[model samples]
Target: MPDAQTPQLAFHNVSFAFDETPVLRNVSFELSSGETLIVLGAAGSGKTVLLKTALGLLRPTQGRVVLFGADVTAGSEREWFDIRSRIGVLFQEGGLFDSLDVADNVAYPLRNQPLRQCPEEQVLPKVEESLKFVDLGHTLDKYPSELSGGMRRRVGIARAIVTQPELMLYDSPTAGLDPITANIIVALITKGRDVRNATTVMVTHRFQDGEILAGFRYDTAAGGLGLTPDHRGDTQTRFLVLREGEMVFLGTQAELEASQDSYVSKFVPHT
Candidate 1:
């Protein structure tokens, strides 16, 4: 078993800047094997930049991005792909291939691999199973152009998890969708946490988005994202409120709500 002390995913004093423009400053956090890490930041607050850093698409100017204690800051692309395979990321947009139908799009990742885990016969069943999880079984023959935004997002999710990754990263999964559909997506995400024992990371700004995450929390192990016994409420979840690329507050959800800071208060819900 992995050490209880070693975090599954970790960022330590991570600082990154583009030329003179600073994005993330001394950001640090740890996510366990089965915990859900929700990141709340306003528009242009470097949330996306942080995801890129985690994915190795962006390198940190200082500190480290660690996965299972292995530093990713200096790895080659080929070296990174090994780590990337263990992670599944849901992009802001569905990021589907318009040319391919849903099934093909979901199966695309397996096609590029140099070796097959199972026989060729296993591919179709896995594809079907993945789509089934997202409730997209009927849309298999349809192209991304033919699907609704919600369906596209679900399809993207199906594609991401088709590989059975250890970690799941969501980038604005509910953006540009109606409230009803967004809620459905939230439920689907929660269901995913229940079905697969995968660590989760989500980035969004809506209070409802925060609420959906709050909903993901519960006293019992069932409600939370498969968190271990050591962490009931002890699991740490903090928010970093950023403005013009600088952090103004770093604390809990309640702390963020009660904050007297003008930037934070303005962003809080009217109620």
Candidate 2:
């Protein structure tokens, strides 16, 4: 298991709010390089906010967000852009531009950028290669309106990783899909992380992907929360539960399974 202190991404006492209405309350966590940590919580749990902060797109109202050994909360615009270039983010909706073709969408991040350092002829090939990586090679010329939801999501993923980002942030990657499609998306997400050895953070509600983190969450008698076993023999995963702008629990999946706290108990699905 990765050590807790080996943080590629760290949030220390981070807090955020909109118009003085707090959304996240002193939340903190760390993920080592090449580790995939899935963030879980009920609706409106600030998962997206956390993801954005890590991406350097949003500033935390309190504390620090450290990336690549630099406090992103302190970087200038150019420095921030440079740090952002090293990471890929696959949004829940896939975030592909409707006006551009699939290949162009993949190339969007590289366009006119001083960082790419590649000539014009090379860009199309790189775009083609990214599409191939996402298994959408044949759809390079297609438009977003012409693709299925799954296909569009794949394209968005292609664009995210096209820059070869060192970290990846995915929001609800498997939402709005069938069982088989969801599994495929999960496989793609995991495969990219493993291949790149990138620090991965997934904002998802599903327990299937949550099994990868190395901890648990607190349970309440209401059964909304529970623990996952430490010795389940699968990868260890941590679970964090947030409610009403407060962090209620942060533990391994094993620990969450054993808790009986009312707030956590209500979430255990009833058969």
Count steric clashes of candidate 1. 0
What TM-score against the true fold does each predicted structure earn? 0.85, 0.84
> What C-alpha RMSD separates each model from the true structure?
3.9, 7.3
Give Cα distance to truth, residue 212, candidate 2, Å.
Answer: 7.1
Query: What local lDDT score does residue 185 receive in model 1, on the 0 to 100 scale?
Result: 79
In model 1, state the lDDT of residue 166: 78
Taken over the whole model, the C-alpha lDDT of each candidate is 0.76, 0.74
> TM-score: which candidate is best?
1
Candidate 2, superposed: residue stretches over 4 Å from native: 1-6, 112-114, 212-237, 262-271
Among all candidates shown, the one with the greatest lDDT: 1
Candidate 2 residue-wise lDDT at 184:
65
Model 1, 187-219: lDDT tens digits are 677666546667778777765665555445432
lDDT by residue for model 2 (1-271), tens: 3354557788899888898888878988777676666676777878888888788777889989988766778777788777777788888888888999998899988884456766778888888888887789999888999998888888888898888887888988878877777766766676666556667788877766565333322233432223336433233335666666566777666566666877654444534
